[model samples]
Target: MVAKGKVGILTTNYYNPDGNRIIYGGAERYGLELTKLLLELEYEVAWWQVGTGWQKEMLPGVPLYSIPETGDNFQTCPRLNQSFYEQAVQVDFAIYFVTFLAYPQVLEKSISISHGIFWDYPSFDAVIPTEELRRERLRRLWLAFNGPRKIVSVDTATIQWATTTWPGLWHKFEYIPNFVDLNLFSPSEQERKDGKIRVLFPRRLTSVRGINEAARAAEILTKKYDNLEFHFVGRAHDDNLEKEMVRWSAKHPNIYYYWKAPQDMPHVYQNVDIVLIPSKSTEGTSLSCLEAMAAGCAVITSYVGGLPNLIIDDYNGLLIRPTAANLTAAIEELAFNHDLRKRLGQKAREVAANFGLEKWKRSWAKVIGEVFK
Candidate 1:
């Protein structure tokens, strides 16, 4: 079927079209995937995001409008851009995957999609750029969301947050879970080398991702078991986070780091016996968990935003508080119990099958089609 029309995806995360996967956040993954789906459905897709950093050999027919960089050199956090407004009006449908960047023109035409808001974070006091700057940026985001034509949240946790926090705009909110590619991340029977089991921390090193806690747990667990290996596979976007990881790796020889780029993650996942997501909150769908599950690795994640929707304690995958002791215990439990890992991993692949790409594509096609019709 022909698509409704041109669809513009607005966000702040840089999209490396030549890269295998989107880095760090759920919003980036959603934006990249949505653009691909729209194009597959024959829609004229235009991707707008801050930063001209990426090499621009985007998908065949898609046009990537790299908005001029405006924020602090250290941060690519959203700010109003005149070009965003000009390009948005040209699209038939607009979707803001990273909703904070939306301005009046973009918001008025856009379906604002949010995983959660700044208030969802336990405390931004520790995250970089003065607390004052963080607060001001959030202030702009607060006013932007109020003007969106419609709202789409990735999980029930966010839907509830919207209804309770902004009751007046509750009528505009809807829930649609994020999608994962089961074909690419499918289960593969693994080969354990030297009886070593791998645990993965796939998220970028950041305060919100609770990297300190996760790195600490790896240290404790590695000291206890000689056969365990841990991989930290994300770019340390912050200097502080990179320093912390460096310190942890120095102390824990078992911890290895890998740069984020296009690579065969399915094979990497097949080798991984477990995937750990320790983000405190502010998760849209925790794409790492879904991808790990789809690849048949047992997952242990925090009970933060939208996690409970994906993992049930000790059923499909494990759940825990984003604490060092709790993560250590969960890690120890799965590390020793080979049978439990096999069972949960199998069930996880089943759960992942539900969020396949085709389903998400059809859903967007229907939703966007109806809105424009």
Candidate 2:
């Protein structure tokens, strides 16, 4: 059990619930869930919301402090208020969720859980493509360098990437897999008897995510197979991509689009026959892929980042190249073979059971215990 001491959770934004906003990503969700778990373990929890409109819909009964009238972007100036620092210092441990701005304030015994390595590599600059944004990234990197405590990555693949890129930080690193709520995402017994094979593509419509490839694959498959339907869920990044995706939807009647709500995801999974994650970039361990697997959806994803670690190809899920042709082929193969889909879906469920909330709780408890000790 966690001792009775104040624990502050630092995150980007906590208002937007799961499956709502893509920018408010999985790290924020994990932070909130981790905070809840820590509270349930009997710890005094305090959250510091740096952005406006973030404190409105926080979990009920949780104490949250909003930084007073600072600039809209608190990440740029995280130390604007001295009172926030004083309150944070009073806590036994501070947990920062991938916030580079909070790095300067992190003291001894503080733990930093990074969802992605934004500063140490050049791939991040591509996402933020502006001179001002690049400057901000550099400033954050400078702050992170002079931070009080060392940061720890959440996954082994991230650790390896960090070690390979910036050597001599191996001692400060540890791997903790991202936690998933098993009860919410567990497989349903209701069999999908729909004649059409429903394929789900639940990923942000970003360049790195390769949503265009998925859309193209859908277009190709729709031309070849009549009984195959493609479903896309999640927010689009830019107006152009959204317009193109919407155009694709108009062109193909079998293609369906939905902006999924968190509460509606379980029911959504029941209708999906297969899940596709055709990410071209080095995707971190994707929660959507895991959630799909947990819901007994046959997963077909590119072998990137920690995907290879989670999905044992042909055992739990299928790993295809990040190309439209390959993805289309995989889809066609699965569409024709119902038994293969069932077997893969069942195995995926078993693999997902290992990543349940209970397992994550135990792992986190051990990490916190060791860190505090």
Candidate 3:
């Protein structure tokens, strides 16, 4: 097949810059899917990221360039953006893997992606730290917004927040939620009948993803119920945090901590009866929540970001304020009430049918088609 044109994607890191190991997470998964979609559409793709000036392959024939640009004052990495802009001159189009990376400058035929509102947490104030810095940040963000032909937002929360922040930028946004592989992540043919109830927290072990709350709930609930098992199946940012989680899990008999690759997650979701997507802040239409829903597992997600968009309160899944107490109570309620769990899980699967991989690909195709045209 003939290629349409070369496309360059700029981001912080697609994989650990120092090594080939992928940082398995929602954003990375989104990037992978986007690249595949572009390839499927007969476009040549290359990826660029802040790295140690090394080159690798993101996929077969898709070059991953590492630009060794460092430090931007606003934490937006404009230097990397500039570096990619300068080096990727041959590319006909560009995709900013992160929305902020398009700031300072962007190519003429380009688009950006907003994962969700990452600064919703209170401590993010320390990043900007002053009114002048905050204003400067907003200014750069506005410039970033202006540069992208269209900003594909993973959730409406980001669009709502962005439009509220800059009242007239609505037309530049595209709402495309994350997707689930319905065929792969469907319910187990026969539900586990061993009488053991498993609750899985299948997210990266980060503070923003409510790892602390999940840990507290696991500690409290595992001690309370004999049939309950709490599984924390994700890697932390560093080896130290991973060790910490393993050590913590060792102290509790019914608690298990392990990490799985992206390909293995569907089986993990199917085995578990309940899934916890208790994100405290900084979330999108979570991939974990959708996968769990597709697997016909009862889901408990916090009422933050795009979770509310996917789950109706007490309808498809349990939506609560992402606290240790709330998570414990929700888990306990579902554990005891098997019928409620079954109903919620079944409805969640039905709802998840709407967000299938094909629908996501079609939505993205429309956006990319427009950009290429």
- TM-score: which candidate is best? 3
lDDT of 3 by residue, 31-108 (tens): 888999999999999999877888888788889889888678675888888899999999999999889999889999
Backbone collision tally, model 1: 1
Per-model TM-score on C-alpha atoms: 0.83, 0.80, 0.98
Best-performing candidate as measured by lDDT:
3
Clashing pairs in 1: 20-262
User: Best to worst by TM-score, what's the order?
Assistant: 3, 1, 2
Worst 10 residues of 3 by lDDT: 13-22
lDDT of 2 by residue, 79-165 (tens): 632335665777787776663645446655666675654433346556667899767755664465335254556557767765675
What residue pairs are clashing in model 3? none
Candidate 2, which ten residues in sequence have the lowest lDDT sum?
A: 15-24
Q: Give the TM-score of candidate 3.
A: 0.98
Each model's lDDT comes to 0.73, 0.71, 0.91
Instruction: Give lDDT tens digits, candidate 1, residues 50-87.
Output: 65534353567776666666563212244434566675
Ranking by lDDT: 3, 1, 2
Clashes of 2: 0
